[model samples]
Target: MRNIRFLVVIYLICQNTLFAQNNPFYNQWEPSPKEGAFQMEDYIVWGGSVIKGEDGLYYMFASRWPKHLGMSAWVTNSEIVLAVADKPEGPFSFKKVVLPARGKQYWDGMMTHNPNIHYHDGKYILFYIGLNYEFDQPEKVGATRELYEEAWNHKRIGVAVADSPFGPWKRMDAPILQPRPGKWDGAIISNPAPVIHEDGSVLLIYKSAPVPYPARNQNRTMNFGVATASHYWGPYERKGEDNQIKLLPISSDVEDPYIWYDGSKYHMLAKCMNEAITGESGAGFLASSEDGLVWKTSENPIAYSRNITFSNGEKVNLPKLERPQVLIQNGQPSHVYFACRNPEGQIFNMVRPLRRNQ
Candidate 1:
């Protein structure tokens, strides 16, 4: 009996070691340009997405803000910008500011952030969050608190459409999806991860909450919800109306979710708010569901961790890695992108290529 138990322990250890050796191609991001290739002069660039356009160049949609605005400026003054690179691992050149503030009347006119670019139905669709402040204060650093709160209280999901990635984008007059009055997502909807299906349908997985909404994320909790539309310019309807928000229950509050349906199942890589639920603070959760509404996290749901081992043999456990996005090139997940600050005090996006067997 003792020998049998020893053999069982040995078998488990060997299996674990073998699994650890099989790192995917995109797991280790290239640390060649230590400062990262996406930084701007007076702006701190974040929230990156890379897409191959008809021009054969990779167009990246990302968020940026003034350097003096501090890290917290993302909420109040962030704007979406476009950059072009010859390759996905880009020495990218700035193209233009894709989405900027219009005015106070439009729902997303005050600020434009969190750009998720996709080519859908023979057009380029840019989905994002916009906020407006009707308050009596100027929107600066400290004085912008009331404005920030109003923006937070009024944030909604808006979309822009264009023929080319380098667009003269035609933005819709109103948000496609808005907060429901008495539903779980009544407060706000942000952080949109949308997948346009081969059948021409759209599936958007976004973060939301109810009306007793707190301004800060760490002070409150968020859940992932699904909405479907036959057309990108839709009539999007939430999957389970009352139970729309709380898919995983309060025991496992998730955020920063990037979801895709890979034909057979829905796959998600989201941040687990509680360390006990997913191993570490920034340890990502790998979950799946056959139907989009029902989800199940993996038995050992550690997708990746903050402690990254770069391709060039540099390894550092950063403070945290936020915003997980996958660049699908040639019909497969070719690279992974995330927002992280380097040791050089520059916050920019990072990428790691995903290969079959590294």
Candidate 2:
């Protein structure tokens, strides 16, 4: 009996060692902006998403505002632009604006922001937010102020399509998801990122605010939720409520969700107001789920900024780092690209390569 017990103890020790090696967040922290990469531009560039296409280049979709306007301009006056790089770690060159301000005759007729892009079924779909202002008089600029006040009460998540990564894209005539009247997502539905399953179903993860509450000028809470569709273009339904759309259980005041699978389990990285393990802003938290619907978060943040500025001379360690997009090489996360805000608290597009081995 004593000999048998000794063998069991040895086997258990080996099993625990193997398990520890597989957890990606086992290490405390890792270095970013790997050697020899150009730092990001100092200007405000938020809402970044990256894609490596068959053309053998990296394409990034980001929200940009002029330097003179400051960060708040994104709420009133910002446009989505595309940037291209020969490699994931830039020197990236500005391409062109993807979504211009709406013309006339649409709800999102004024400002456009919060871009997330994903390729599905041989096409690229871009999701973003559109704010509409209803002017009392078309001729008077001052009257437009009251119009915006009423419209600013809500925002919608809109979708657009492109045949190629770099393209003259086509926008959907209407939004895929909108705010519900008295629910968790009633106030607003923005920041959309689509997840495509192997079985050909699509899941959309987005941020929302409560309705019948305070105005944009007032303080409000933003939460995340998921919606599903049998096809990429639907009539998509929420996970619960008899296809009536339901919200996810976890509540962390989190935004900008990026999801991925590692063959064994699904993982997510999101931006939160809560202090991370390092107790700093711009720190990202990691979570895992055996099934995609439920999630388990780590006690500490898995990723944080090291106070290294980008090439554009912008301070790297600001409180605002939203939109976490993962680069999967060989089926694992090799790098993460985020929307980094400047020292003054404006958003900018930046990329940080992860040390997977660590």
Candidate 3:
């Protein structure tokens, strides 16, 4: 009986593995192009989103901070900038600063990070997390944990709109999403991922914590919540029980989600924080939902890995690869983007092409 039971378990595991391998999206990764990387000599480049402009140009809204201040300074010093390319995958060139530090008086005054670009109703929408603190910009020497705590807890999700990607972006004076006072999202909201419908309705998934940062312990987990807005601009309301949309079945370690719709259903790709879901922490996982609220893990959940293969047949393992954004063109995912870092703390954005189903 013991042997029979063991064999049954083994067979189930094998079946699951086979199912995972069958995923259309997971099986479509092409080697990333070396020239597709976007980096600056004196800046730390992070994640970005790309959209095809009406002028037939590709525009990427990405985050960057001074290299001297280090990556952690993203909480206090980062700004949203625009990069343009002739093709979807390029050696993109910096165009201009789209969202800079306006003033400490406003909620998103100090920093703007994790931009996700979208188009709805003939307008360009940029969603991102912004923060402000009482302290001045830290020197190259680095920021204290206390300062990080102060800046981080103020983090809120906001949006900017413009007629074109080359925009005089009208940034909101108030945040579009704020934390609940004593709920699962009591602490803060960051990492806005939205799928905009043809009618301009938005289904947004965002990261939240029960308690403020630096106060979280082993029991505290970073989770995701879903919100819907009838129109992209107005009153957004949380969905699901306590607004906690269960994107992952096993754990709350997933974050930096990128969501999109492919005509029928919603699909998401996010960083697997630990080894629970993907068995490789920091690798990305894939999930899908018939309805936006009830999400299920993909049969083969692994989306991408930190071990990168270049188009020229070279391979390198990166230390950190987070904040994934998929560029959807002609009703399919064409390229995947990421914020990658080396052991020495150098940061840059990368793009990998995907094989389209013929």
lDDT per residue for candidate 1 within 179-248, as digits (tens), equals 7766667778888888888876888888877663353543465677888899787878888655453344
lDDT tens digits, residue span 76-132, model 3: 899999999898777789999999999889999999999999988789999999988
True lDDT of residue 159, candidate 3: 88
Could you tell me which residue pairs clash in candidate 1?
A: 25-353, 25-355, 26-353, 26-354
Instruction: Using TM-score, rank the candidates from best to worst.
Output: 3, 1, 2
Evaluate residue 101 in candidate 1 and report its C-alpha lDDT on the 0 to 100 scale.
78
Question: RMSDs, each prediction?
Answer: 4.1, 5.5, 5.1
lDDT of each: 0.73, 0.64, 0.85
**Against the true structure, candidate 3 has what lDDT?**
0.85
Candidate scoring better on TM-score of 1 and 2? 1
Candidate that would win on TM-score: 3
